[model samples]
Target: MSDRVELELGDLQGGILSAYGKRGFPFGRFLLFHVNHPAAGRRFLEGLRPLVTAALRWPEDVPKPAATLNLAFTFWGLVALEVPTRTLRSMPEAFIDGMAARAAILGDDVGRNLMHHWDPVWQVAPGRPRVHILVMLNAAADREGRPVPELEQLTRLVLALAGQSEGGVVLMEGHAGADPRFQELAALFAENPDGTRTPLPTEHFGFVDAIGDPVFDGQYPGRQEWAKCIGQGAVDGQGNWRPLRTGEFILGWPDEGQEVATMGLPLDFSRNGTFFAYRKLHQDVAAWDTWVAARAAELARLWALPSLEAATATLKAKMAGRWEDGTPLVRAPDWESWQAARDRLATASRAERLAFLTAFTFADDPDGRCCPKTAHTRRANPRDMLDPWYRDPDPRARRGSILNDRRRILRRGLPYGHRDDPSGEHGIVLLAYCADLSRQFEFVQQQWMGYGLDFDAGNDMCPIVGAHGPDAKFVIPAPREGQPPFIATRLPHFVSTRGGDYFFQPSMTALRMIAQGMVDPT
Candidate 1:
């Protein structure tokens, strides 16, 4: 399946990955630490942070002193301890209790919060005892070529805290996305002190060693320009935020008002912060591929095209409201409109552009006629095209109208795992940047992915990544200019949301404070 890519070593967490082979539990955590320098990161993290410790914060208005941190956590939440990194063999009774306690905290959400929601089919998977620790550093280093950070040292700390023995197993994981810095780090790690890198597999479809970074190069100055208007209304001299100019909903400037500092807790209060969500979703590759093949057939029939390209064109046209080549179907249903919206979304005020896209036209009716409500892009941001009938009754109405959208997220994750590995399932780690996780990322998942109701109402889940019934059957209603909507039926599941969790990415200032052990939660 196109979406069911291969899994690679680069994609799998370095520690305890092999345990999955026997369905054995491998507990782990992915951590991103804000470090003042590589030296500081290593020295401070030589031992695991205790769970009883207070949350830290950076000081106000202070950017990180050139270091930052983020962490990914995946453990059974059983046999809990207050200390970090407990090993299986050496795990103390206290550590086991800590794990158990943490697991209990997570289970509390099982029947209540969508945040706690997991596939009923696979709750047993995580229920198995395991821990996967993944960490990401998203800040510029004090200087490159600092003695490479030791993965083994960090692992040992975690094992010690968990009270597990050395043979208990642990892996230090790293990713090389499209980013140059990450590439540098991966290159360093993939090689030994003698300077030889791991051999690239001829047929390896797992994660590649190519590094990808999350920091945007600021080639697009719009982010800086838009920062000024983030809190203030997007308006002219009259001060009325114009619908023609900006989107209906505006988040305004990020720094406006007496907002809580990034490090309001035990950390410095001066740095910026980013949130993260992590998951260790296992893919049943064989099953996913089978579903993809079956779904492709349905797509072929729906678009009346024999090739994937033609079907993709129809799919893209309906979802983007245009084609990949950039044609707006509303203006020229058959042409591409990549040019119109691309630069505009990156440059124009959010509201100004959103209004234009959401402006309904008689030429393309969305009432189950043109774009399906569940299309990926459509579900992410409905562009005010959701059926009015369903709008009022939206279970998540507190998030407000989707027409004038806000809380746009910037995606920077890279594809992981193997591209052709029959043994493993692989895809992008799927990272995003949003002003607020609750307002933006969480909203999209809950309303669109979980609810699966969009402009068309009671339609199939999103064509990509969205879920539907246990059978995983899906369909995309056809979009003929004047003809009745043609339902492309019986599509199979391709991109399954294996599993993930939310995280808070602290700025450099926060990292320094965290190292100093004085972070305060905002």
Candidate 2:
């Protein structure tokens, strides 16, 4: 019995496969809420369902609709609403204990990672329960207008629904996304001539963001990119060439192991649902500029480069594993080659650019010379780069992209705050989706981004987003074997987490059960 018929595309929400894809919106916010009344909450949740975006098929000619809204519940939130005890017990321990429970496993510092930080607006102080549900609203913007109207209407609708019900409380959580004071900060990562609808623009760091996301079941209609994006998901005598299985990301489907995932005992309730990690990352622009300027100059002198700016840019690319424009080092190993790729990409169509941008892999550049093994991109995605990092036991697992296949995350986030303010509130609001938070999202954060054991560079960390206290180093050996290696140490923090939590986006069927009070223990 295939789960597809049981959990059809229409059963899921659009946010699962849409973010950063063709359906991606320019603006969005996560309105975190809590249940004030359990009895009334059941009624309220059912009412809110009408507003949730369904897995509707999008056509090529018609632009995918904007002003999308989705709902995600936390373990505490569900408990607050009096979920069936038997059902809760069936859930994985990881989901019921909440994201904080997995903090230790994720190797996060209690204070630094804010594994326990609550929303400051609530003044709940430390060690208190945070909000339960997250109302994710997404929309696009034009030069003259942002998507504030759609978001405002949707927010008001949620409040109105709660007003009549005795169960839920609309949280007044203050987020930078809705506040006017951070308007400049809001548009920080946005394109020029603000509020205009643009497709996945670069972040304040002055580089393109969100590329090479995993390709899944072609949910977004009239799109061929998703199928082609996998870059040969399989392997043969020639090389690997196949897309990852859809089940690896979406629940109730066969994963890379060729087995369907089990979402607790009642497969009907959790089949089409997935997990999410919402992070508010604050970028330190001033620190990055100051540190990079000095380091690039030093590199120029050591490598006998042309100028400080040139060397600095190259050094930045080395750290990120891609050129500022999003070209991978494997495709263009040197500054000169990268510049040529950049120029050619400029004239290509958007479709051509996106395909070209993510087409390359580490199969050819196994050595760190082309793209450093510890580089941010290589560490984060790896993509047929590592030599059996996970425990496979079987010798046959020594090769291919199976090691990092399940680790892929569907990145669906936008930049927040404006670059206008050097010290102002600005950075990316990262929203990543995966079937297993422990294996995918948290794994990348701990093993790949924060540390460097997988790359064989010792404890060396990702230069761009690694949280290694105040002092850290990013070492790059000279492109030529004999030249002196360039070492950039004492990398002041370029990014930090403000506050965030994990969420469980349930299927529409599960939502109906909760609303009708049909969730009693089986």
TM-score of each: 0.50, 0.88
Error of 2 at 388 (Å): 4.9
lDDT of 2 by residue, 1-522 (tens): 112222365688877766623464667765667777877777777888887886665653334665777888887777777777777777666677665566565544533455343335322346654677777777766554466477667767877886786435656454544462121113332345654544446788888777767775544343453445545243321344555667767778778788887765477667788888777777888888888888888888888877776787798899999888888888887778888888898899987887678876676665588888889888878876664422344535546656688788888777776666544577887778888787788889888887788887888778988876655787786788888777788987677676666777888887777667776454
Give the residue spans of candidate 1 off by over 4 A.
1-43, 46-134, 137-271, 280-309, 315-332, 335-365, 368-370, 386-407, 470-478, 481-484, 520-522
The C-alpha local distance difference test score for the whole of candidate 2 amounts to: 0.70
Clashes of each: 129, 15
Query: Model 1, 207-237: lDDT tens per residue?
Result: 2211111111111122432332221212221
| Candidate 2 stretches greater than 4 Å from native | 1-7, 20-24, 60-64, 110-129, 166-168, 172-200, 218-227, 232-237, 388-398
Error of 2 at 216 (Å): 2.1
Would you list the C-alpha lDDT of every candidate in the order shown?
Answer: 0.35, 0.70
